[model samples]
Target chain A: MISQNSQTILNVQNLHANTQNTEILKGINLTVKSGEIHAIMGLNGSGKSTLAKVLAGHPDYEITQGSIQFDQQDLLALDSEERAQAGVFLAFQYPIEIPGVANSQFLRLAYNTIQSKRGNDELDPLEFDDFVREKMKLLEMNPDFLDRSVNEGFSGGEKKRNEILQMALLEPKLGVLDETDSGLDIDALKIVAKGVNHLSNEHNAMILITHYQRLLDHIVPDYVHVMESGRIIKTGGKELALELEKHGYDWLHDNLQNNAGATA
Target chain B: MNALANIDYLSSLLQTLSTQNPGDFPKDLLPENNFPWLKQLRTQAIDQAGQFKWPTTRDEEWRFTDISPLSTLTFKPAQPGNSPALADVSPFFIEEANNRLVFVDGFFTPELSNVNHKNQLVVGNLAELATSHSDVIEHHLGQHFKSQKNLFSALNTAFLKDCAVIIAPQNTVITQPVHILYIATQAETTHYPRCLVVGQTNSQATVIEDYIALQKPANSSYITNSVAEFSLAANAQIRHFRIQRENSSAFHLANCAVSLDYASRYQAVSVTLGASISRYNLDIGLRAEAAECIIDGLALISSDQLADTHTCIDHLQPNCVSHQQHKCIADEGAHAVFNGKIIVRPDAQRTDSSQSSRNLLLSNQAKIDAKPQLEIFADDVKCAHGATVGQLDNEEIFYLKSRGIPELTARNLLTYAFGAEILNRISIASLKHTLEQIVLNQTQHH
Candidate 1:
């Protein structure tokens, strides 16, 4: 629910990126305002995740043209970790396993890193442990999850929950969640959605890149953007997802062809 | 490798070693040592040393390792000098261990040792218990090693003056670990540190064999040719920890052979951290039915150093199990080699064995050669072997960097974690904590 005086958190102007001599994100233009949720729904290989990674300053992607503005700063000028410290967070689709590093250690490092970047005092282990446990309760996470290795033997749902837990810890300004709802059952989807919804407030924004509109029912989006072939083909309200759920994406493809025919 | 030059080096070393230099060499291997059998053993070892020329690169056994640096310097045997107080060697002591045998320059220093003789455990040097434990010593001491076969093993036995010996009697269970501390003091000297531990039937004991230098010199050069043999009788359980942290300029060559009898279990961990050029040969034999052996090793080397580990797990009888994991981490022009061979003999049916060698290279100049060989003669045996040589995973680095952690700290954390897998297996709390900190400090250094 965005008010009239809401500030702009993320603004992408014709962002073009390449990786391994292949252009992935071509001319992606969008604006995410504070206190709003935008769902970028697309099929596989439609560059939905690529846009998320590009916004997060992933090293593999080289921004060939255009720019991204986060909190009025040039996001492209920062490194990946610098971008993360600057409040641009990308929840990975598949979290990596770092053996011998406890989940609690990794989470606290992430939390304190961003906390100190924001000129806030860092919490000790005991204080951070208590704070993180309170956040973990939002996703119905077991306390034992902190003792194990980071995503080493976690189930698919547990790995996604850990990503959301990171989002809740860092409290990023713009959260670009790439395929967060891919590997979750209905119950896990509700729990993760509850956590994400609890984290969303009037000051931070979220761009959820998902394949299905089922996630939109739990955490309603303010706007829905349909992407095709590395570009957003259409932008509509939350009711558009309901239309797409009733009629498959082929309906939009045929409708786009008809509209182009009529306009020509 | 010039064949003629290698032969000359071998022959000269053999000549220097086989000839009796009574006045110059330490008196430990003298002709008149009171025990006629000990004299016979030393002479036999010398004759065997003559037969084995120095191993050249042409030898299939030492293909990846070139130890020609050892032949450049003339060597002198180490002598027992001034006795240091307990405070001098306390830094390397294990607080949990009750029995400690400190060997300075390969000679047993009884003044520095603390042995509890009333705990059904017998601990002494070779000369002290040579008569009382002569039956066990004569049967197992020199008989276990490949004296007639390997060059380093033969030299170690021929110069065996004083050896740290531990005997766990039948049905006796020694609770705390017995620390065998071997300290090398002088540079340009050759020292032979020997150890023989025997566990009788149904006996159990844990022993830590530590090798260190008294001084920390960047240019110190010494030769420590060590040999330790362990014989475990039926239903015996022996856990051995061998740590070699000599000076950075020292050449540490060692051979450890463990023989496990029927239903016995042997768990051994060997860590090699500091050495200019070092080679450790571990040969474990599961002699009888239901014998099991678990072997773990780590060789962390950096900066022009070379560390080589060759292990052979021989499964001699039926119903045996052997698991071996060896890891090597090399950085900044260091080279590490791991050759793990698992042999399942013909009669060793139902033998389950697996061996893995994981090597990590931190720089472009770092080199690693990991070779896992399996020779299974029994058709029904289960054997698995693999070798991996790689750098840190980029995805893991990206994962860490994405969490706002700097790239350098991420790399250091991952590097420490790689070596921590083996350090986690250590049982002694103090030793394990010390090693963990050492691994974190050394492996994570920029």
Candidate 2:
């Protein structure tokens, strides 16, 4: 899908970010085109989720030195909601539970807010309910989830599917999914992958930050990047993910160190 | 507000409270000839009200709640001024309610009241049913509240000339809910609104005790000392909805006590939303085996308002179950207090009880003091209690914001959700929708 005219949806250059007092992301570089799917694989503390949150303009993180050009505009200038309205979405690894607010109402508000920003005709409650239900079917989500509280009392797989369901509804230009496949079972993961794939067009992009190659099988990333300690050390094609799956991270680390020693 | 702070002695405050407000207490009490027992109860309560010291923050129960500002208001007793027409009061009316008893300035207004139930259900003013239901009233009136000896209850009982009373006899089930409206017409006056609900054997009913201001609430700085007593017979059930939305400048002190017999059930949802200082004490006693009760409450306050709710569910017999959940949402410099107490006696084995108090502070200056108390003596009983006071969850807000909702809308959604948890438990659909809309508006654009 990386054609000649595919737009550059995101470009991160020397991105250095900090949370509170600690520098989490130190001089990172990444670029995602409109039709490209990038999979950033790393361990637990590798700051993959931090990158996703920073892209979504989460209030906790501060960019000390970096520039994120999203769709040829500065992404860092927008607030969280403004970033969302600009078609940037982050599917949280641990989705926060909002009790007492119905999922349908929240979904409609979000959908309408984004649609209004895009100059599209926003759907009313009944229209949105029907629309969301169709999108939910893509994720194999039960219609009953629309009435319940957002993410409250939902099963792990169900919460993951809900995140994907939201992704299908928002139809963001750049979707930063942080560990969305971690808690999902095989069936849910495929359903979520199908939902995400259905939303991806040549005008949009996705950044999949996952720990397992199992998800990359269904999503099929164009680029596989290995990150260590807040920096992307190695980049390769889709086969690199399978290699990482077989040898684990130590193979890449050893090769990286040997190459560094030879080069020095 | 600081004027009452200078009076250090509660006794002197109590003295001034009683002497300056002659008309605040009933002058010509219900005649002893017709209602001698009630007259005696009122007389005893009058003496109790006289001797009792004004509650202060020094008392364990009143700690964190300072009601001394009540002395600043002129204790002029409100009168039954021009009664509000149907249009003025109809906004507070529940659409499904067929029976209603209206009280204007603590005096039962027969012209505005109506009871249309064809069954053996008794719903009307207490004074009107004095002759026929006298025996029933005599046995239950002030019977549950007599032991509490609370100064506010005593003051309310002393003014027990007239109040809303609903008596559901054996095997009777009320089809529609009964609405008891307590309206304040005149400002700067002290009024006492009382309620007595008796559910006989195997009977069932729903009663709504609502407080409202006749005109604009800001101008009505009345002092309302209200008391409501519910007594349930064997296998009976009563669903009560008590709403206290007095004026912002008013003081509302209310006492509600319930006694459940064998296999009976009592469920109440009390919402407190107004008043400069409001205190509601609710006590439920499960007197027999297999009795059950669910007590839920919510208080939404902002500005200089202070709302306090103290609830006690006593499991006195074995095989009883009680569940209580109280929530408060405080913004601005407002203060909200919730004290939920659950007691399981020695003989109350196999009793299951749980209590939780959730308070949401919407601002840094907003204060909430939530205390959950569990007293269990039976090892075989199951008891659980918890209390939490916090601001809106930032992660939750971010989650909503990530979904394209604005930050203010997200915060309002969380705040509305916190208060709506209790309001959703309200059995009445119209009232639930109303209160939910009110909370929605209160949490918006702030």
Candidate 3:
């Protein structure tokens, strides 16, 4: 639960983003405070993924209107890398495969870059090897994955575990999991949720963007928000997810249409 | 008039050649000890070269590359004793080479070369070997390369004398590679460097022919015509690498011909990075059954540079295999071309051959033309060929940037990786490492 004294980590107001002159996110508003977990559940084409990408500053999306404040700073002014350095991490739904670069080298470079940006001492290859091995144990990742190309031939579960491994290494202030539960088996989903739970603390917050409430079962969310047509249509406690799972999204869709017709 | 225009450059070069005195050429540029037969061969080649016309844009082989600049300029034969300091050649030198031959302007520089494994193989200057190892040299040199119709090949043979020669005797395996560095130092000068390698029966070896030049001059215009001939006896395995990293304003034309006997294997890799205009012609002839040939190449061109590679592999006997993979990266108005052809003769049944040419264009103005051809006269053969040219995937770039890597770093990494695909074929670990570093540095600079 988010206490009254908890400070806000991410605040958005009337966020609007579009691509190719077609608006995807008409207007979105959300507030994520420290020491809390918020789950954004939506059906297909409801712009949940768009919200995740816009938060990470994807170049393809244009923010025509609205403001995003992270740690009380203008998040819209920052580039993707700058936002990453400022403590925002987005776990992609589909990770990309870089063929030639070894996973260890890429992870080390990213780790050192962020460390140096924060004015912290960086680890050399040897120290990083030991440090990363320890982090990999949390995700049950095999040691051989370090020598292979980043996500080149990894299975779906392996790719998701790698993403969580990076999040554990970066230790960002706010973590956004975009459909992290997709393509994962029940056992793999449990491991991922457990890893995320282990990383969360009082100072860092997380936003879980998912389609199914099954993921929320493993890692219970403090608040549940229903998204429809690029906007948050409903907000409730943890029980809302169970209710949505029980009744499905058809009832919500019918109820929203009837409400709009009645208002007109 | 159109035909005349097609051979205009060749005609102009002939005009310049008609006034030359072939006899007045330096002693090092002629046959060793004035061998009458060798001298006669040179005379015949030069005579034939005089009648042949230089290829022009109208010719299918030279369609994408234009040699108008070479036709307009007057080039003098490069003289000896004008070599740059050792510091200038050190960057191109590999530390792992057991035997090395350094040639400055086509003349062997003994002071800078090192030959230590005399017991395992014979490595020395070709001119001296022509006199000392006459029996071994006469049977192989100039015997395998019979057709001198190609202008550049004829030119190189006509003016070649001080070449590098490596001979691995029967059952001999040279662990370390033989490195030959050919360096050019002057503008408006032409250098013809030749290399001959004979691997006897059951012999195995690797040879690296590295072509480089001194730092860029005010007028960085020169010409290098190089030729290398290899003879692999039955059961022999030879790996050859031809690396051309010359000055940006230079023009380089080279030909590498190989003849393989039964069960012999030959892998030849050509890496072209420097020179304003560079062209490589690779020809491999599998004369006996079970012979395997692999021809791989990579060209990285930028800033108005042009690099073209033409490869031909002939399977003359049955049960032979040939594979070719050529890649090119063009950026910033550069142009790259690849033409690969594989021929399976009528008697060469059960021949397996594969050819691929992949190209990446980094800029909108960059151009790449790749043509992979396969001709199979035999009924039972497995032959496949393909060509592709495209830009980097936007999704890849965005993915990299999403990981906090800058756009420039992501591009460089991707470009370097693309070139590394071919470099990975190199078996020498240190050479691969050095080439990777060069690829990284060069790609980042662009």
- The model with the greatest DockQ is 2
- Sliding window of 10 residues with minimal summed lDDT for model 1 chain B: B1-10
Residue pairs with clashing backbones, model 2: none
**Residue A163 displacement in candidate 2 (angstroms):** 1.7
lDDT of 1 by residue, B1-446 (tens): 12323454344545565575666555553344577788788778777776665776899889999998887666667777746667878988999899999999998888889998878899988888888899998899878765224877877877778898899999999879999999888877788899999999999999999998875454578889999999999999999998989888889999889888999999988999988999999998898999999999999999999999999889889999999999999999999999998888999999989888989998899999888888888999888888889988888888887878888888888888788778767899999988888898986755
**TM-score computed on alpha carbons, candidate 2:** 0.91
What is residue A34's positional error in candidate 2, in angstroms? 1.2
DockQ values, each candidate: 0.55, 0.65, 0.43
**Model 1 misplaced regions, further than 4 Å:** A140-144, A185-187, A238-248, A258-264, B1-37, B118-120, B146-148, B170-175, B216-219, B348-351
Deviation in angstroms for A76 in model 2?
A: 1.9
TM-score-based ranking: 2, 1, 3
Q: Compared with the true structure, what per-residue lDDT tens digits does model 3 show for residues B219-316?
A: 47889999888999999999998889888899999888899999999998889998999988888899999999988899998999999998889999
lDDT tens digits, residues B13-123, model 2?
Answer: 345445744355443334556667876887788677667666789999999899877755556555554577888787887888888889998888877877785757898
Evaluated with lDDT, which candidate comes out highest? 1
> Model 2, A1-264: lDDT tens per residue?
577898889999999999988999998899999988999999889988899999998899989998999988899898899889999999889988877888898889899999998999999898998899888877778899999988889999899888888888888999999999998889988888998888888989999999999999899999999888999999999999999999999999999899999999
Best by TM-score: 2
Query: Which order, best to worst by DockQ?
Result: 2, 1, 3
Every prediction's TM-score for the first chain?
Answer: 0.98, 0.98, 0.97
Stretches of candidate 2 exceeding 4 Å from the true structure: A258-264, B1-30, B72-82, B215-218
